[model samples]
Target chain A: MHELGIVFEIQKRLLAFAAGNGLSPASIASVVVEVGEASTVIPKYLLECWPAAMDGTDMEDATLEVEVIVAQVQCKKCGTVYPYLEHDKICPSCGAWECRMVTGQEFNIKEILVYEEDVPEDGSLGGDPAVR
Target chain B: MVKVYEIKQRVLANNDSEADALRSELKQERKFLLNLMSSPGSGKTSVLMKTIALLKDDLKIGVMEADIDSAVDAQTIATTGAKVVQLHTGGMCHLDAGMTRQGLEALDTDGLDLAILENVGNLVCPAEFDTGAVKNAMILSVPEGDDKPLKYPLMFTICSVLLINKIDVLPYFDFDLDLCIGRVKELNPDITVIPVSAKTGEGIDEWAAWLKNEVTAWRDTSSSETIIAKNKEYDK
Candidate 1:
C-alpha cells in the first residue's frame, strides 16, 4: 500500500519530464527503476502499482522495468567487502561485526524513454508516423 | 525514420541525497538520534513511555512519533511533558528521512538533550530507510515469539539495540529468551540486548539508564566549545 506513494512519485516525475520535453503524454515507452535489496521495496509490488498510478496519465502505456541491486558491506578491520545478508551480520573472512555497506539499498528511477511524434514538412506534428 | 534513445536516471537516489543532508545537519548539531523500530504490537510505545517517565526530569528529551494512522501516541507522550511531535504517515508503512527532517524542523531542539524517533510500526520497511538516527533500536515483544530474530534477521542485524519486551508474559508463553538472544547475537554480535517488561515496570530502569548514558555521552562529546565551533564551521 505504501508503494503507491512511491509509484505516484515516479508517475509524477515521468509526466513532468514528458511535458517539459514537448512530448505528448502518451509518448512514453517505458520507465526504468533501480531498487536495492536493503531498500525493502518489493519489485513485484512496485510493478503491480505502475498501471494504477499511470491510469489517467500520459504514461498509461509505459512499461516498468525494475533492477534489483544487492547490498555489499566492507569490513572496517579486515578491509574485505562482503554481501550484507540478513542472516549473516559478521564478515565471513574476519568475523568482524563492524562494516560499511557498499551497495544495494537503492531506489531510483533511472530513465524514462519517450518517443515524440514526428513533425511533418508543413511544420505540424503528425499522428502515428507509421500511418503515412 | 526510426528513433532510439537511452537515458539514465536514479529515481530513489533523490530521496537518499536529501536524507544525507539531514544526517549531516543532525550530526552538526551534535545530537545522537535513535530511530526505534518494531511491529505494531511490539511494545515500542510502552518502552518509550516508560523511558520518558524515568528520564524526563533529568534529561531534556524530544520525541517524534510516526504512525500510519492516529495521533494517539503523540497525545500520550504530551502528558509526559516532553517536547514531542506526532507524524502521520497517512498510509505509508515506513517513515523516511525526509519525513524525519520535516518533523525535526517543527521540533525545538536547542534545549533538547536527546531525541528519540519512534518509527512507524513495522520490521521490514522501516529498517530500509535511514532517518538520520545514530542508532537503530528494535523491540520484540514476548507474545511475538522467540523466532522473530531468525525470521526477520534484517531487522535484528541492522539494529544497534534490541529490546525483548513483555517479559512479564514469559511465564505464560513459551518464548525462549536464551534462544532468541542467542540468535540475535549470532546475526549481530555487536547488538545490545535488553529484556524489559513495560507493563510491570520491571527492567525498565535498566533500559532507561542505558538510554540516559547514551544521551549523556553524546552531550558530553558535543558540549565542548571547540567541537561546537568546529561543527559550526563545517556547516558553513
Candidate 2:
C-alpha cells in the first residue's frame, strides 16, 4: 500500500530533521502529521503503517499523531464557503458547482514533540524528561 | 524538558522537489515526458497503442508501463517496436518521482524524443504523486460515467488534458459528452478534453498532434532558463 511508502517518507524526513536539529532519533517523542479530509491519503492507513515504519528505528517507541483538516470550498459565484462533500460540491448560497478548494487538501508535518532531556544511549538517565 | 517544534512542512515536499529536478533534467536532455494516468479498463493501453502508432513514424518514442505486477502491458507495447520498459511498483499503487527516474535511467533515453509513462491503473493515488512528466494526461472512458470529475476532483484539476475514450459506444451508454466536458472545465479551466474511440482509431490524430507539438516545443526551446520559465508560465 502507498501508506507504507508514505510512512517511510515520514521516517526519512523525521530522521533528517532530527539530524539537522541535533536531536537523538530516540528523542522524538511523537510526530504530528496533518492530513486533509479530501487529500489522497487516508489517516487510518497512515496510522496502520506507522508502527511498522518505526519497528527497527530508534524512534520505535515514538508515537504518531494525525491532525485532520476538514474539506471545505469557497464558492466562486457567491463568495460563500462551505463543507465540500457534506454539501455534495454544490455551493449552498448560489447552488454553483464552480468553486475553489479552500481547505482539506493538505498533507503536512505540523510539528514534532521531542524530549528535551539528552537521554544517553547507554541507558543512563541524567534527568527525567518532563512529559507534557 | 518537553518541546514542540513547529515544522509545518509538506509531507510530499521531498517528492515534489525531486519531481521538479527530474523535469529540469528531462528538459536539458530535450526529451518530452508524458505521464498518462487512468483507472483500470479505461482503454489506456489501447490509447497508447494508437498514440504510438501515430507518432512512432515521426518521433523516437519510448513507453514505460508501470504496474503493481505483471509485464503484460509492456509486452503489448513491445509489439509496436518501440523501446519499452516494465516498471513493477513492488505492490505500491502508484509510481513516485524516484521510481520514475529509475525507469528513465533504465530506458536509456539517449535517442528518444517522447517518453510516455503509463502509470498504474489507478485514478486516486497516481494523481497524488508527480512522476516528473512535462504534462499530465488521463483518459476517462464513456462507461465510467460522466460524473468522474465530481468524484475525483484532484485528478481533473491537475491534469493538463483529458481523453474521453470509448466514444464509439456513446449510443449504447447514456454518457453526455458535453456535460462531462463542462464539469471537467469547471474544475480545470485549461484542461483540453478530446473524445475518441481507441478501438476505431478516431480522434487519434489530434492526440498525436498534441504530442508532436509538445515534443517540438520541448526540443526547440533554446536554453534551459527559457524552458523553465515557459514551463512555469504554462503551469500557472
Candidate 3:
C-alpha cells in the first residue's frame, strides 16, 4: 500500500528531527499527526504501519496519534464559510466553484514529545550518588 | 536545574516545498501537464494513444506512463512517435510531484509543447496528490457504472475534464449516459465531459481537437515574454 511509503517518509523526518535536536535513543514519547479529509491517508493503515516502521529504532515505544481535519471552504459569492460534505469542492450555500479551501488537505506531523533522563544531584551523569 | 521544551514541525512540509518548486518549474517550461487518472481497464492507455496519433503532427507531445510494474502502455504509445517515458512506481498507488519532476528531467522539455502523465490506475490515491499538473483529467469506463460520479465524487470534482470511455460498449452495457452526465455535472458543473471509445476510434477526433486547443491556448499564453519572465521568477 501507499501507506508504507508514507510511513517511511514519516520515519525519515522523525529521525532527522530527533537527531537534529540532540535527542538520544528512547527519548521520544509520542508523535502527533494531523490529517486532512481530502488526503488519501487512512489513519488505521498508518497505525498499522507504525510498529514495522519504528521497530529496532529509538521510536519503537513512541505512540502515534492521528487527528482528522474536516474539509472546510469559503464561498466567494455569499461570503460564507461552511464544512464540505460528500467530497464536493463547491460552496454549498451559494453554488460557487471559486471557493477557497480553508481547511483539510493537510498531512503533517505536528509534534514530538520527548522525556530526558533525570539528572543526578551529585553532578554525575550515570546515576544517583546517594544510592551509590 | 535545566528545562526542555517540546518543538513541533511538520514532517511533510519539506516534501510539499519540493512539490511547489516542481510546480513552478513546470510553469516556467511553458508546459501544461495533465495527469490522466482511471482504473486499470478504463481505456486510459488507448485514449492516450489515440490522442498522440491525432495531435503528433501539429504539437510536440510528450507522455509519462505510470504503472505498478510493466511498461506495456509506454511501449504501446511508442508507436505513436511521441516522446514517451515509462515510470515504474514499484508499488505506490499514486504519482506525486517529486516523481513527476524526476520523470520530467528524463524528458526533453526544450521546445516541448505538452506533457501528459498517465497516473497509476486507481481513483482514490491519484486524486489526492497534485503532480504539478495544470489540469487533472479522469477516464471513467462504461462497465464501471454511471453511479461512479456519485460514489467517487472527489475524482470527478477535482478533475477539469472527464472522459467517458468505452462508449462503443454502450450497446451491451446498461450505462445511462444521461444519469452519468447529470451526476458529474451535479458534483462539478465546470468540468468538461467528453464521451468516446478509444477502441473503435469513435469520438476521438473531437477529444483530440479539444485537447489540442487547450494545449495551444496554454502555449500561446505561456510564450509571452512577460509571462516567461514572471514564470522564471516564480520558479526561482
Candidate 4:
C-alpha cells in the first residue's frame, strides 16, 4: 500500500520537475528510483502500481528504473561499519551490538532520463559564418 | 541521445520534513509523543487502552488510533475518558508525518501531557517511515515467535522500546524469552525490551511508569529555558 502511495508521490514530483525545468513532459524517458534494501517501498509493488499512479499524468509513458541500495550498519561502540545483511548488525571485529544504520533506509528518486534535445545542423560555427 | 539528470532526492522527503516540524513543535509544547508499531493482532490497541486507563488520571493524555477501517479501537479508548481520535487511512497501510501531525492537532493537545499514536498494525512498512514521535516502540507477542528479530530485523533495529506483549500466554506458547532478548539485543543493543501482558496486567504498571518517566524526562529537558535558547537560535 505504501508502495503505491510512494508511486503517486513520485508522479507528482516528476510532473512538477518537468514543468519547472522548462521541459516538455513528452521528453521524459524514465524516472529512476532507488529502493533501499530495508526501505518500506517494495520495488516490484511500486512498479506494479506505476501504471495506475501515472494514469493521466504527464509521465504516463515514463518507465520507472529501480536501483537497489545495500544496507550498511555502523557499530557505535566499535566504530565498524559493514553490510547489515552480512553481519546482522554485530561488529565482526569487536562484537559490539550497538549499531546505527548509515544507509539502506533510503527511498529516493535517483535520476530522471530524458530524450536529448535535437541540435540543428544549420547553425554555423565561428569558422562557418556567411563569409566562409 | 538520452540524458540522465541525477535527482538524488528522498522519495519521502515531504514526510521527512513534515516530521521534523512536528518533532520541534511537540518539543516546544513540552509534550511527549510515542509512535507504537507492531504486527496486526500483536495487541497494540489493547496495550494502548491499558496504558491510557492506568495513566489518564496522572497525565493529561490523548490518543490517535489509526486503522484502515473501523472505529472500534477509538471507541475503546474513549471509555478511558482520555481525548481520543480515530483516523481511517483510506486503506493506506501507514501514517506519515503529515498525517500524524494532523491527528495530533485534532486531538486538542492544549494542556495535554502526553499523546500516543497507535500506528496501523504492520511490522514491515511502518518501521520504514519516521512518524516524528519523541520515542518509538514496538510490540512483539509470544505467539509471534522469537524469530521475528531475525526475520524482520529492520523493525527491531528502529524501535527505541520493545514490548513483548501477551506474556501471560508464554506458558502456552513455545516462546523462549532469552532467545528473543538475545536476538533483539544483537540487533539493537540499546533497546528497552519490556515484557508485559495487557490482558492480565502483569507488567502494565512498569509500562505505565516507563511512559511517565519518558514524558517527564522529555518535559524536563525542554523547559522554558531551552525553548528560549532555541528561540535565540531562530532569531540569530
Q: What lDDT is obtained when candidate 3 is compared to the true structure? A: 0.76
Candidate 1 segments whose C-alpha is farther than 4 A from its true place: A9-28, A34-39, A55-61, A67-132, B1-11, B220-236
Best by lDDT: 2
Sorting all predicted structures by DockQ, with the top scorer first, yields 2, 4, 1, 3
- lDDT string, candidate 3, B1-236, tens digits: 22223333455555656665765676667677778999889999899988888888888888999998987889898888888999999889998878988888887676788899999999887766667676678999999999888567668877878999999989899899998998898767778899999999988888888788877766666444453332222121
Local accuracy of candidate 4 as per-residue lDDT tens digits, B1-236: 66666777887776666776787888888888999999999999899888888888889998999999999999998988889999989999998887898898888888999999999999887776777787788999999998899778778877778999999989899899999999899877778889999999888888899889989888888454443332222111
Kindly report the docking quality category of candidate 4.
Answer: acceptable
Top candidate, metric DockQ: 2
Across residues A30-106, which tens digit of lDDT does each residue of candidate 4 receive? 88898878676778898899998788866788899899899898887888888977886678889876677778877
What C-alpha lDDT does candidate 2 achieve relative to the native structure?
0.87
Q: Which pairs of residues collide in model 2? A: none
How many residue pairs collide in each prediction? 6, 0, 0, 0
Q: Which pairs clash inside model 1?
A: A36-A106, A107-B12, A108-B11, A108-B12, A109-B11, A110-B9
Which is superior by TM-score, 1 or 2?
2
RMSD to native, candidate 3? 7.3
Scoring model 4 with DockQ, what do you get?
A: 0.36
Root-mean-square deviation (CA) per prediction: 7.5, 4.0, 7.3, 7.0
Tell me which of candidates 1 and 2 scores higher on DockQ: 2
Chain A TM-score of candidate 3 vs. true chain A? 0.76
